[model samples]
Structure formats: C-alpha cells, structure tokens
Target: MTATRTSSLRIAVAQLNPVVGDIAGNLAKARAARKEAAGQGADLVLFTELFIAGYPPEDLILKPAFVKACEEAVDALVADTADGGPAIAIGTPLKRSSGLHNGLVVADAGERLAERFKIDLPNYGEFDEKRVFQAGPEIQGPVGVRGVRIGFPICEDIWGDLGICETLAESGAEILLVPNGSPYYRGKVDIRQQVVVRQVVESGLPILYANQLGGQDELVFDGASFALQADRSLAFQAPQFEEGLFLTVWERNGEEWRCVEAPVGAIPQAEEADYSACMLGLRDYVDKNGFRDVVLGLSGGIDSAICAALAVDALGADRVRTLMMPYRYTSKDSLRDAEDCARALGIRHDTVAIAEPVEGFTEALSRLFAGTETGVTEENLQSRARGTILMAVSNKFGSMVVTTGNKSEMSVGYATLYGDMNGGFNPIKDLYKMQVYALSRWRNAHLPKGALGPLGEVIPRNIIDKAPSAELRPDQTDQDSLPPYPVLDDILECLVEGEMGVDEIVARGHDRELVHRIEHLLYIAEYKRRQAAPGVKITRKNFGRDRRYPITNRFRDRS
Candidate 1:
C-alpha cells in the first residue's frame, strides 16, 4: 500500500476599514494585505465585503465615474498580482444587464476565477441595500484554489434559512468562506454567531467570517471576526474595536474540513466594547477631518465626565479642556468634582462662572416677560449662556466642542437645543444614561487603548456616585425633569430600539402612565434629534441620520 498525503490550506482574513470612494487607496490596502498573507506562506488572502469600494457607499455607487475608477483599480491590482504571492478574493460593485449587484470577484495571480453576487439585500434598520443593489441568483459551486474547492457567499446570503451553504455543499465545496461588512450594533455579535452556526450545521463545513471595522459617518463597524468549526466550536477569534489581520489553518479529515483550533482571544465586555467603539469613532472623525483638540463643558454629571475621559483617552491630555460654567444654582460639590476630574486627568481646566452672563440675560429678558413667571424658559436661558461660552471658545481657540448628552436624554426632549446640545461631536449620545455610568466604572478599572493621561481615577468618584443634574435652576435634578435613569433607560430600550408600543412595554411590568409619557416624549423629540450633531452609535437604533421618524406624523400607541 502507498502512503497518501493530503494538502492543507492556510487562509488569511484582513479586518480593515476603507474610506468610501477612495478607489486607489483601497486597492493599495488590498495589495498590502495580500503581501502580508503571502509572507506567511498562506495560499489565499480574503477581504471584507465591498473591500474595493468600501461598504454602504449609498448614492455614491450610482455614479459612473466612481464605479469606473473602482474597475480600473481592480485591473491595476490584477496586473500587480502577476508577480504574486497569494491569490485574492475581494468585494466590489458589479454593474450588470439587470442592475448593480454587490458582488465579489476572485482571482488567482493575474487571472480572474469566479464572481459571486449577494442574493439577500437587507433593507431593514440602518440597511438600505435593496435601494441600491440587485440580487443575484445563488452561485452554488466553488472556485478552485490550491487544487481545493472553496465556497463563497456575500453577506446576508448565509444569514437565515437560505440554502446557499447547502447548495454549495451539494456542489462539492469543501469549505465555506464568508465576506461581510456588517455594521456595529448592540447584541450583533451574538446574531452573527447564531447565523454562522446555522450555515456550519447545514453545510457541515468549517467557516471563516471576516468583517470591516471603522466609523463611516454615523455608523461604526465592530470587527469581531470569527471562525467556526463543523462541530460548532469557535476556533479562531479577532479583537473588536480595531483593525487586525490574522491567518488560520484548516486541515482535511476524511470528507470535511476542520479548523485547527487556534487560541481564542478574550472579547471585551459589553460596556468596554461600547466605550472603545465610541472613542475610536470620535478619534477618527476628529483626526481625519483635521481637528486637533476638543473642548467641553463639565457639569459634574455622568455624561460630560465620561465624554471628557473618552476625549482625553482618544486625543491625549493636551488636546482636551474642561470648562466649569457655574451659576448661582451650581452646587459647590459640582465645582469641586469638576476641578478634581480635570486635575486627575492632567488636562487644561478653567472656571468661567456663568453668573455674570446669567444675570445680564435675565435682566434683558425681565421686561419682555414681565407677566410670565419662571419655568423651563429660565432653565433654557442658563443652558444657552453655557452654550454661547463653549461656542465662543470653540471659535476663538479652534477647538471642537464635544457635547455630552446620552441616548436617554437625546431620545426624550430632555436636552435643550442650541444650549447644552450644541457641539461638533458627541461620544456618548448613543449610550443610555445607565450605560454611561457602567462605562465610566469600566474605564476606571481598566486602562483604555490609546490613553495618554494618567492611569488612575480619571473620572471623579463623587461624580460617578452622585445624582445627575443640569443645575440650570435651584436644586435641579435630572429626576425632576424625567424619570429615574433606571426606569428611563429601560423604557428607551424598548420604545426606540425594540419598537415596542405602550401596552407592550407596560406588559414588561412598568406603570402604564409612565410608558405613555415616555412614548410621547420619544415621538416629540424627533424634531430636536433632526438638528442634533452626529454621535458614536452603540445600539441598533440611534437618532439622527440612521433612524428617520416623521415629526408631524400622528401615529400613537393606542395599546
């Protein structure tokens, strides 16, 4: 009997963030990734979905020049691969006879092998794929690589009860490789795991999943690339909140391919993951757009404190400045806490007491409002005063003002427009108030990536443990204007992201009146959110740009 030897294939997955419409730049990234894979003696290099043109180009993909430029870049990349190391598989848009397809083209050296188009175009919740892409009938077979058959499925193909994997398996594909440009949202990783496991169970083949990571305007992609073996075990894992590239080996055992288990790295906790994503998104937005520093008003509240810590961590201590704009109602404790936090972080701090401006504004408005007593009008005036000071500093010093309203406040009409709401960027606008506290504690416990300030206690402990207040009026507390954060955050999670109606949320054991009030507030805040600045998103549904609701609509939660 002659001894038989089976060949093994090593595939490298590149987790990268590419700028949209940057054709030449994306091609250079692909070339560099291929070179890295080749250096490791891997047989093939794989990139995320739409790697050539970047994901979700929206209307830009409809342009003829942009698509033509992408095609030319692909051609140049093919020419360069002639001297090659590893074969390449990358995603791009394909303009066909029927329509434009979100497609992937595979190549060996300089020759094109096979092309596959995504069959499922998701149009729900932050995805508008159906608006731009024409789906292709599933390609069942595999492309030959190193004399082996590998299956390809564009994102959304393996997501559900789709038979793409089964079809490929029946067509004699030994392994499945999925390329995705999935966006970030809370609990999305679990969703990915469930979908990938379904494909693995169906095809009985090991699968490699790669995803893009970065902030594209209002969206952020969390790169937690993973691999699953036929036995439903997670074989290899990549870190979240950053770009990475790694190789995994698959071995053949009898009929199916099995992933040789690589060490699984620890994934960040929910709070930590959310914090890092916010910091990275804000950092990139500032750096890429040529803003060097950030300035924010610190109210000794959870929102501004967390934003300050994140800004310092993202852009260094020298680039961050905190201003304590105290008024007559401003608590002494708040001033002391703000000073402590600034001193702890080693960032620039100043006290520009707003009492002078507050008095002047009240004196000016007294005659016009002679008949009316004070209410939210007076509260809003104080906020406007602080907003003016922050805006002036932003103008004169050229520092971007970082707003610090969390998602809870943003969802309701709790935030004052043209007041505390004015800023160039907000790091925590997507997080709930409860989440803000959790992340603040997490940062205090562990050092965040790219942190340049001192390691211990950046946020004052008193601030984290104290009640949140705007201090716009005497003895003001957030609880006075809205429900407690514990109840408010839960209601928001259901009403906004879950899309649950009043009765449905009430079924969750909350007071019906409170639920009704929250629903009304959420609906009314659409107008304010429309004018709000973009923020880092950590949830499935964030206000502004991503979730568009009508301000004049009369939909009510009758239940």
Candidate 2:
C-alpha cells in the first residue's frame, strides 16, 4: 500500500437484498448498482458475502449446475468492468481443484485483478458450509486496484480466530474490506462491532463492513453496514433492515487511510429492531416465494392481532387479509377486538364460522366413541377447524397463511398440530408471549419507517390488555393448561437459551415442581416443533436453527 499525499478513494457500499438461487437476478442487481456507482464517480464498489448467488444457499450449493451458474454470473459481472466504469468487488461460489469455496473476486477495467477464498467455514447453528464447500487453503495477499492495496475477508473469516485480517495487514494491505451475511438476533449489532473493533486494533487498518439485507427462510439479515478509521473512529453507519447504495470517500493522510465523507444511517435497536425484522421476514418470504398476499386467523387474541399488524406493515393493507373463525366458545369481546384492529389497519376482514365443521367431525366419530367424555380432543377440533378454514382461504386465493403462535406456547406444546400450527409461515414464532405484547404497544405508539400500516393504535388497547386464550372451550385461557406467560417465558429462556438445569431454574424463584413440569413439556414438544412453520428468529436460540434437539431421546434434565 504505497501512500501518497493527494490520493483519495471513492468506495460505494451496496447494502442489497438478494434472493437465494437467483443468479440472473443477482447479476442484474450487481450491474445496476455498478452503473449507479459510476454515476457517483465511485472508484470501486463493494458487495456483501455471496452477493451473486445470495447468502447461505444451503443444500442448493451442492448442485453442480448451481455452482456453475454462480461462477458464470461472477464472470459475466467481471467482464462488465470493461465498460470503463468503477471497479467491482463481489462474493460468489468458486469451484477449484481443491473443491468448492466461498470466494471473492475483484475486477478493474476488463481484468480480473484479485481472487480470495474464505479461510474459515462456520459449521454450527444454521451454517453448514463445511459439509459442502471446502475451507480456504491459505491466507493470500491483497489486490491492488487504482494504486491502493485492499484486502478481502468473507463472512466468518474475521469472526473466527484464523487471523486472516492480521495476515493481510502484515502482507502490506492498506484497507480491510469485509463482506457479510450476518443475521438478526437480539443485540447482534453490538457483537458485530466488537468483533470488528478487535480486528481493526490487531490489523491496524481501516475496515469497511458491508452486510446484505434480506430474509431467507427463517433467517433475516440486518444490513447495518459500517466503517471505521484506522484510529478506531466510526466512519459511517447504514440503516438496519434497509437497502441502499452508500458512498464513502477515503484519503491517504500521510501513512493511514481516513474516511472523509459518508452518511451515518440510523440504526434500529431492541424491540423496534425485532418488530422490523419480523415484518421484513414476512414481506420477503411472501414476495420472493411468489405469494400474492397473506391471510391469518385473527381471534382477537394478542398473538393473532400482532401478526395481523406486522403483516399489514410489511405488505400493506390491500395485500393483507384477516379472518375470524368463530365457534360457540368465541367471545363477543374477541369479536369486537379483532374487527377493531382490522378496521384500524384498513385491511380486508372476513369471518368464517366453524361450528358446522366441528359438529360434523364429532358426529362422524360419535359412533366409535359413544361413551367417551368431552375433553382436550374435542377442543382441538375447534382449532383444527379454524386451521383448515385459513388454509382453504390461502389455497383458493394463492395467499400464504401466517400462523401466530408465540415462542412460549410453542415451547410447551400448547399449540395443536395440524390445527393452529398449519401455515406457510409464522411471524411471531420466536417472540415470547410477553414480548408479543410489548411489540404490540410499541407499534401503537410508534410507526416504524417504511411501514404501510396506519399509525396511532393500529392494535387496539383492549387487545393488549386482554388475557390470551384459544377459545376452544368456554372460559378457556392459556394459563389453564400452562403457567402464567411471564413465569413460563422466564423458565423457557433459562432452559432453552441458557441450557440451565432444572435445579438451577428452580433457584430463580420458580417452583421446583413447576420447573420440572415445564422442562418435560419442552422436551416432548420437540416433535411438534419439527413440523412447525419457519418464522423470524428474535432470541439467541430459536427453535429450528439455533437450537436442534432430538425427538426420540429420553434423556431428561433430572437434576
């Protein structure tokens, strides 16, 4: 990195949203961003990890044709550099003699300037790159473009203890550029910054971190891209859960690169971040998967009401549809609350009574169980009837069904299988019952940026204040089958995320017998969770990705 007094670099960071397996679409997006960057007189443009093929292509990466398509797309983009515009640096999958690898290539003016492979492959949690792609063999040196030496580190390279960033700096790299597909969980932005800060201190070089924004399956990436000066000062921040092409100017000041111009984008945090994540996840899941709209059974309960609000905020009122599947047990208060919420959000609302279906099923089975008493099975029929009605609406109109079960109920098998759990996707699957109420209140008081839903109490006050229930039976409440939500949520947090023993959980003021019961339920519910629909992950350990438990095991937290 030869330094001069008058050298300045104009870099454009593309915080984009890419659909997995859409090589042609991703390439078109890259070309468009490059064109816009050229208009801004950018010397170079940087994109997030696997930008050409989208992030975490999962088992799709194993296909030979898929890998070839990704490589072809990268080559096409590299050839586009011959247009005499800004240089391009993007991530894609590369097949080599060593094996397939997550690779980054830099191009300038019709020439492939530099190529690098990911040094570390993450295997834990939702990442299973090691199962398919080969880890990078060695740490290569930086590439020189426009007389500046820039190093590339793909996602999980700098996060691990491989020292790839430090090695690049030692090899005369002046700037560090890291592209990532980091997903959203609570407090993830802070954790990412701390990781980069440590790397910056060790490498003694400025870093420009570019992360993509989009939802793939259950995971949603928050693109709060940021940069830091060599002196450890924040250069700029891109807004979270947003897509933008931002430019930053860096000058060679004596020996080190320093940022001169950049936009500091607003960063969403905590509950707002979580709410926006669910909304974005729903929007992308519905749009990318080719769904025209979404429908969910709104029972005037907190969970269904909040899901309705999030669906409206994501896809607008015109695209969101709500249904109230009523039975004999359905209360008038619930009827009023659900209607009020739909009215406030200005969405299409409809009602479908399930009494005939419930009665028909009962009569068909009455001969086989003439002496059987009415209990949980009979109540579950109500739920199943409701589920079937919502799915029918979806099938008839091509709209996806959004299930509204929270994490607390899902933890203890509180949901009925093929009943309330039947849906194309879930919006609040990771949020606890308490957190669901909190977000409901937050949405009423504050309308998040870019939300299509109306502001000022889109969710009614009565909905937030009401006790949650399934209404499968007369005077039925969630607490009748399980503990209070506040107590259950705390116990669940300890057992699921903390992996705490029953004895330890009991010590936190919970009853010893109750802790034991909740633990057993959590383990037994693994089967139901296995079949549950995917949703946005808000906690440290969501059901499907972050935490994977065995369904046939008998090992218990007997402690």
- Which of the numbered candidates is closest to the native, going by highest TM-score? 2
Q: What ranges in model 2 sit over 4 Å off?
A: 1-6
User: What are the TM-scores, per candidate, against the unseen true structure?
Assistant: 0.94, 0.98
lDDT of 1 by residue, 428-493 (tens): 989998889999998888887656656878888999988888887778788987988999999989
In candidate 2, position 409 carries an lDDT of 88
* RMSD after CA superposition, every candidate: 2.9, 1.3
Worst 10 residues of 2 by lDDT: 1-10
- Tell me the lDDT of candidate 1: 0.85
Instruction: State residue 285's C-alpha deviation in candidate 2, in Å.
Output: 0.1
Q: Could you give me the TM-score of model 2 versus the true structure?
A: 0.98
lDDT of 2 by residue, 30-106 (tens): 99999999999999999999998898898888999999999889888889899889999999988999789899989
Q: After superposition, how far is residue 56 of candidate 1 from its true place, in Å?
A: 2.2
What residue pairs are clashing in model 2?
none
Candidate lDDT values, in order: 0.85, 0.91
